[model samples]
Target chain A: MLEYIGKRIWQTLIVLFLVSIIVFVMVNVNGDPVQSLLPPDAEPWAVEELRTSLGLDKPLYVQYFMFVKNALQGDMGISYYQQTPALNLVLDRLPKTVELALAAILISIIIAIPAGAYAAVKPESPFSKFIMFGSLAGISLPTFLSGILLILIFAVTFSWLPSSGRGDAAQFLGMKSSLFTLDGWKHIIMPAATLGLYMVAMLIRLVRAGMMEVLKQDYISFAKAKGMPGRIIYIRHALKNTMIPVITVIGLQLGRLIGFSMITETIFAWPGMGKLILDSINRLDRPVIMSYILVVAVIFAFINLTVDLLYYFFDPRIELN
Target chain B: MQKEKILEVNNLKTYFYTREGVVKSVNGVSFEVNKGEILGIVGESGAGKSVTGFSLLRLIEEPGEIVSGEVKFKGQDLLKMSEKEMNKIRGNKISMIFQDPMTSLNPVLTVGRQITEVLIFHQNYSRKDARRRAVELLEMVGISSPEKRIDHYPSQLSGGMRQRVVIAIALASNPEILIADEPTTALDVTIQAQIIGLMKNLIDKFNTSMIIISHDLALISEIADKIMVMYAGDIIEYGDKGKLISEPAHPYTQGLIDSLPVLERDQKRLNQIKGLMPSPLDLPEGCKFKPRCDYAGDDCPEGTELFEVSKAHFATCRKAQFFSKKLMRGVG
Candidate 1:
């Protein structure tokens, strides 16, 4: 198990390295952000001076080497637009993003698993048909459109809650989070629902398909033949066996949720890393954009690693190696 | 004196409502298992033997339904009982072991846990007591080092050992009627003998009435007190073990017996029945076995219900009555 974990960690490092290279190349290929920082009427020499000062005058390979070296030492360079450490800016909003993403996933899981299992058990029932079609609609609608529609319904039409922006509230642990407070719950409802509903659709389908397949297995028949109670048969024998694939899908999607929260963040004006990244892109803040790409890549790799580790707990058939 | 009947089935018809047509999987099959007797059901593939076993437990799934049946266990009509009531009788009084031991047991659970689960659910054994009984059950099935073997998952065990575990789980609550559906079919010949031996021993110890379904007549005859031969979802022949094997009444049963290879003699080719079982959806107007039977003729009657040949033997064949005079020499 230790050797397996060590190998996985090594693989993650190599992946992160490749992601850094891709981020570096992609960000550089989009032309210089230093050029954009200068005013439209500024003199060419002033632009050159600014470019030289920022080390953009150096060869591309030399700049890449410098970028990588600095990155290794926990330095993501400084944001040209904000004049602050790029990593610090991304990190500052990390907690809020994490909070939102976690809540969204929590909501998805809380709704999807039981709903999916129930649907799988009664595939032809009216209740299951409603759940199946509802998820279909959820999947069909894009996140931004769904987010806007939710705002119109709850905030515009009903006048029940705030439409945009994080709630006007004090910070919890230096992050504007509604995780603990009831007011935060009200604020989080719209964004989380927007993000969670889409995920719930995918996860519900995954879980339902998985449950149906596992329930058909011979072991399930054996369990039934043993006269295992309906509850134990469904939950312990059927559902537990169904979760390995669902967990894999869940793990892969979590990384996507973190990255894809950009639209939801923009729609709601949520003060999170997604919004920060979007603003940086609009301004073409190269350092911040590059760092955000690398951070997102790292998170993706980290999440998959955690998922692979999680496989050992759910499925005994899987040997760690 | 005649032994008390432990299980009785009357005209059990399990049909699959498929897109093409209704597949009569177990059509009008009826038999009885006496107390402490092993009734072996023998047939070729797609002969509805397994379907018969599944129907007994009401384990048939979607697209298939028990169209009509009367399954009485210890004089109580099992078919008339509600699912909740059936659940109480299932593992506690009537349990089953299936074919393919490799897939029969849950791969994720330890064999011990699987057995203990049955004991706990059916017998109301506490965890500690169940664990102890699970080990004993394993031992009863001839698994070595039951304490350590109990912790191993089904995947970790060999095919024979996994079969032992399946039997152990089936016997966990000491069920009065054990339905073993082709239990040893997935095993090697040596392992098959060992498993059969173990099962017979366990049945004797528990005074369990058993229904052992198999395709091999020889295998069934070794453990079965009475033998039932099915053909295309119908019980074509059924009788006391010795009488049925010695003088198979139906032509299909004779073909099955003749097809068995003898060790002492070498033949140019093995005697085999000419054709496969007719598709259940397109069964003929007359007897199901008529097309396959060697003695089938224009004189062969349309009605194919079991006709009593002797005191305890019955065969669903038009030629069964005349076979005693014409083909009596064929009997060894």
Candidate 2:
């Protein structure tokens, strides 16, 4: 198992390296940051001095190597806009994004697994039909629209929740998170729901389809023949099998939730990496954008590795070697 | 001798309500299994042998319903019992093992867990006691080093070993009867013999009545005391194993017996039944096997009901007399 993890970590490093090169090339190939930084009436020599100071005058390959060397030492240059270390800026927003993603995934799992299992077990029931219909609607509805609707319903009309921003956060395990406070939970509910709605919809369908397929296997019939209680048969036998595929989707979706929660973040003005990345992209803050993309790539690799490891746990047939 | 009937069925009809039409899979079949007897239900695919086995345990799922039946176990009407009551009887009083050991046991579960679950559920054995019993059961089923093998998952075991685990699970609660549907069909030829031998020993040791369903007539004849031959959804021939094999009264049975290759005879080619079994959905009018039978005559299209071919032997064939006489002359 240790060897398997070592192999996975090696693969993850290669993937991150490729992602770094791609993000570096794509960011540099776009219009120059120097052109955007200086004012229209600025002297040409002043612009040249600013460019030299920012190290933009160097060749692209040399700049990339310099960036890589600094990145290896936990430095990712300075954000042109923020005038702070790019990695620090990204790391500052990382906690909120991770919290939101984790909460969203927890909500999706708590709702989707039971709902999906029910849909598969009693597929002909009215409640199952309703769940299926709701999931379908959830999948089609855009995050911005859903976020606004939730804000309108809970904040504007019912006045049950705060519509925007992260409320008072308490430090837990060296990370400031809203999850510990009731008021913070009220503030977070809308954005998390908006961010997690599509995942809930997708996971429900995946779990249901997977459960249905597993339920059809001969093992399920044998379990029934063994006279196992319906609860044990469904949860212990069927749901465990269903979780194999569902876990894969959940890992991938969690990575997506953390990285691409831009629209929901924008709607609610939640202080997270999505909003930071969006701002950096518009201002052409090369350092922050590069760090954000690389961070997300690492997250993807990490999650994929975790999912592969989880497969061995869920299915005994899957050998780690 | 008057043997005790452990299970008796009266006109059990399990039908599937498909989109096309109602598939009468097990059409009004009646049979009985005596205590300590091994009854084998033999047929080709789609002949309702497996359905019959499932119907006894009420394991038939959606779309397929046991529309009408009276299943009496130990003089109690099993069909009339509540589902809760049936659950008590299933796996506890009457356990079942399925074909394809590779697929029958839950892959994620350890063999010990699967076996112990039955003991815990039915017998109310404590976790510790169940674990101990599970090892004993595994050892009884011919699995070596039961101590270590108990912790291993189904995938870790060979096919024969997996089937042995399945049998161990079935017999964990010491069920009065076991229903094995095509038990050895998914096994290797050599493994098949070993499994068959293991099952025979286990059944005799426990004195458990069994209904072994399979398509292989030769395999059935080896283990079954009584053999019931099914065609389409009906029992065409049923009798004592010795009588049935020696003097197959029905033409279909005769064809089936003839199809077996004999070691004494160096035949250039093996005998085969001329045609395939008729489709269940669009069966021919009258006899279901009329299209496939060489002895099919003018009167056969009207269909023939099962009649006594000999004492304790029944067959549904118009030319039963002529077929038996031909068989007798051939034997002489």
Candidate 3:
């Protein structure tokens, strides 16, 4: 088991290296760092000084090494706009983004797994037909459109909760302070809702297809023949078998959540790295933009690694080696 | 002959409802097995032998229904019971072991959990007790190192070993009647003999009745006290194993017997039965077997009921008297 874990760790590190290089190359494309970093009004000497200071004057390889060195030490240079340490800025907003992303994933899985299993079990039922169409609609619909639809309904119509921001800290973090409890949840509500709707739809469709295929396996028939309870068959036998494929989608979905949260974060005005990246893009803050891209890349790679481990645990046939 | 009959299936009809018109899979099949007797139901592929076993356990659900029948176990009708009540009988009192032992067991669960889980649900045994007894059941099936092997997953085991695990699970609850559906068909001939030997020993030791369902006559001859031959969802011939083999009553049964690739006949070229069993969807107006039977004549009609060909041997063909040695050659 230790050897298997060691192998996976090695593979993950290799993937991280590839991701790091890709992130660096992507951030640097389309413009010279000097153009983005130094304003046009700046003196030629000042441009050269800024280039040398940021290590852009050095060879690309040297700059890359410096970038790697700072990233390892958790010094993500500085934000181009705020001029604050990029790492600190990203991390401060990181939690909000992660929490929302996680909520989206959790909500999606909760909706999808049961819906998928039920759809599989009763293929011809009207509920199944509705769920099938609903899932398709979910998968095909744009995240931005769904976000807009949600904002219009709960925010414009109901007006029960704040339309944006992680509400108040006391509202979210204050359980003992009863008045702050609803406020905390309300603060994060719109962002969570916008992100969760599309994810729920995508996840439901994948889970339903997975559960349907699993239900048809010989082992399922064997389980039923053994006279096991229907629920046991669904949860234990069918669900476990369904997970290998679901995990594949999960890996893809996690990467997607981080990559696509830009729209969701923007629509709800949630203070997250996604919005930070966009803000940095508009201002052309090379350091902040690069750090945001790098951080998201690292997260995607890490999630993939964890997902592989989960697959290894769930599927007995999959040897970590 | 007078032993208490544990199961008696009478005129059972199971049809497969498909997009096209219904396929009459098991059409009006009937048979009985007494307590402690090994009754073998043998037939070629598509002969509805496995369907008979599945139908006995009420395993055939939606898309296929037991259209008409009385499957009585101790005079209690199985078909009439709700799924809840039928489930009680499936793995406890009347357990069934399916064909393809590899696929029969779930891959995800360990052999130990799979075996013991049934005991927990059916007999109300606690987990600890069930686990302890699961070992005993594994040992009973002649699996070596039952304690060590019980924790192993299905994929970890060999084909023969998996089959043994399947037997252990089937016999875990000490079922009154164990149904072995082509249990040996998946293994090599030597392994097949060992499986057959293990089953006979286990059946004798436990004193539990069994219905060994297979198409191989030689296999059925080893354990079956009585043999029933099925053709196109109908029993064309059925009687004592020795009598059926030596002097088959029905023309189809005789054709099957003559085509046997037994040890004594190995010196000569093996004979294969000519033509397939008639389709159940489009059976002959008279006898279903008339189209395939060598001794088929004017009287050999589908409507003819099984008539006594000998003292105990019964056959469905009407022209049994006109059958000759010359007609036997036409089968191969």
Candidate 4:
């Protein structure tokens, strides 16, 4: 197991290196950092001084190596707008994004698993049809539009929930969370639902297909022939095997959730890394943008590693070696 | 020699409602198994033998339904029993082992856990006792080092060993009737004999009634006291194993027997039935086997019931008398 983990970590390092190269090149591609930093009326000498200070005056390859070296040491230069360590800025906003994604995934799993299993068990039933069509709608609609639609219904029409912003937060495991407060939960509901809707839609389809396939396996018939109750057979024999594929999709989607939360966070005005990345992009704060991308890449790698471990845990056929 | 009837099926019709039309997988099949008797069912591919076994356990899935049938186990009508009642009889009184041991057992579960689950669910044995008994069952099925193998998952074991585990699980509750559906079909040729031997020994030790389904006539002849040969969705011939093998009144049965290579005879090629069984959806108006039977006459009747070909032997063919005489003359 330890050797497997070591191999995964090595792969993660290579991935992070490639990601850093892409992020750096992409950030630098959009015009000059000097022009974006200095005002239009500023003296040429002043701009030159700023360029030298930021190491932009050096040869491109030298600058890239310097940036790579610093990044490898957990330093991605200071944020152009915040004038603070870009890594620190990204890290500060990481918790809120993690919490939102985690909550959304939690909601997705609770709704999707049972719904998918039911649809698989009775694929042609009206209720199953409703879930199937509802998920289709969820997948088709954009997260931003869904977020606005949810706000319109619950916040604008019914006034049962908050429309935007994090309301009355509490501390959870050293991170600010609204989970402990009713008002906070009300405020988070729309954004979480919007993000979770897409996940639920995808998961339902994956889980349904998986469950349907698993139920057809010979083991299921054997279980039924053993006279195992329907519920036990569905949950223990069918569902457990079904979850194998579902868990993998879930792991890959976790990174997507964190990456794709930009629109939902913007609509709800939730303070998260996605929002930070969006703001940094508009201002051309290269350090912050580069670090955010690097962080997300790392997160994706970490999740993939964890997912491989989970596969080993769930299936005896998957050996660590 | 009236053995207690452990299971009896009456006109069991399991049909699949397909997009094309209804496929009568097992059409009005009736048979009986008595205590400690191994009844072998032989058929070609798609002959509905497996479907018959599944129907007995009510294991048929979607698009398929047991339209009308009576499965009496120890005189209780299983078809009329509620799901809860059926659950009690399943695993506890009636259990089944499927074909393809590689796929029959759950890959994720340990062999021991799979067996123990049946014991715990049906016998109400404690987890500790179930575990102990699971090891014993494994050993009983001829698996060596049961202590270590008990923890190994199905994938870690060989195909034959996995089948032994499946047998162990089926026998965990000491079921009164065991339905083995092509249990050795997925194993190696050499392993096939070993598995069959293990199953025979286990059945004898437990005195369990068995319905062993297979397409191999020679394999069935090894242990089956009574043999039933199915064509399409119908049992075309059934009788004592010795009598059925030697005489084979039905033309299809004769073809099957003739197809077997004999050590004494150096025939250039084995005999084979001329054509395939008619598709269930497009069955002919007359006899179901007429299309494939070489002895099929123009006046062959449709839906012919099993008629006595000899004392205690029955065949569905209308021209059994001619074949009986022909076979007698050839042998003499």
Candidate 2 on B1-332: residue-level lDDT in tens?
A: 99999999998899999988888899888888999999999888999999999999899998899999799999998888888888888888999989999999999999999998899899999999999999999899999999999999988999999999999999998999999999999999999999999999989998999999998999999999999999889999989999899878888888788778888776678788888877678987778888877777776636546778898788887374577677545543
Residues A8-92, model 2: lDDT tens digits: 9998898889888999999999888887887878899999999999998999999999999999998999999989999999989
Local lDDT at A251 for model 2 = 97
True contacts kept of each: 0.70, 0.82, 0.38, 0.77
In candidate 3, how many Å is residue A73 off?
3.5
User: What is the TM-score of each candidate's chain B when compared with the real chain B?
Assistant: 0.96, 0.96, 0.93, 0.96
Relative to the true structure, how large is the alpha-carbon lDDT of every model? Answer: 0.88, 0.90, 0.79, 0.88
Off by over 4 Å in 3: A32-49, A168-182, B262-268, B301-304, B318-332
Q: DockQ (Cα-based) per candidate?
A: 0.74, 0.83, 0.58, 0.79
Clashing pairs in 3: A116-A208, A167-A187, A171-A180, A171-A184, A172-A184, B286-B301, B286-B302, B287-B301, B287-B302
Which parts of model 4 have CA positions greater than 4 angstroms off? A168-176, A180-183, B298-303, B318-321, B324-332
As a TM-score, model 2 comes out at 0.97
TM-score per prediction, in order, is: 0.96, 0.97, 0.93, 0.96
Cα lDDT tens digits for candidate 1, A257-280: 888799999999899889999899
User: On a 0 to 1 DockQ scale, where is model 3?
Assistant: 0.58
Worst 10 residues of 4 chain B by lDDT: B323-332
Give the per-residue lDDT digits (tens) of candidate 4, residues A33-59. 677778899998999899888888888
State candidate 1's TM-score. Answer: 0.96
Clashing pairs in 4: none
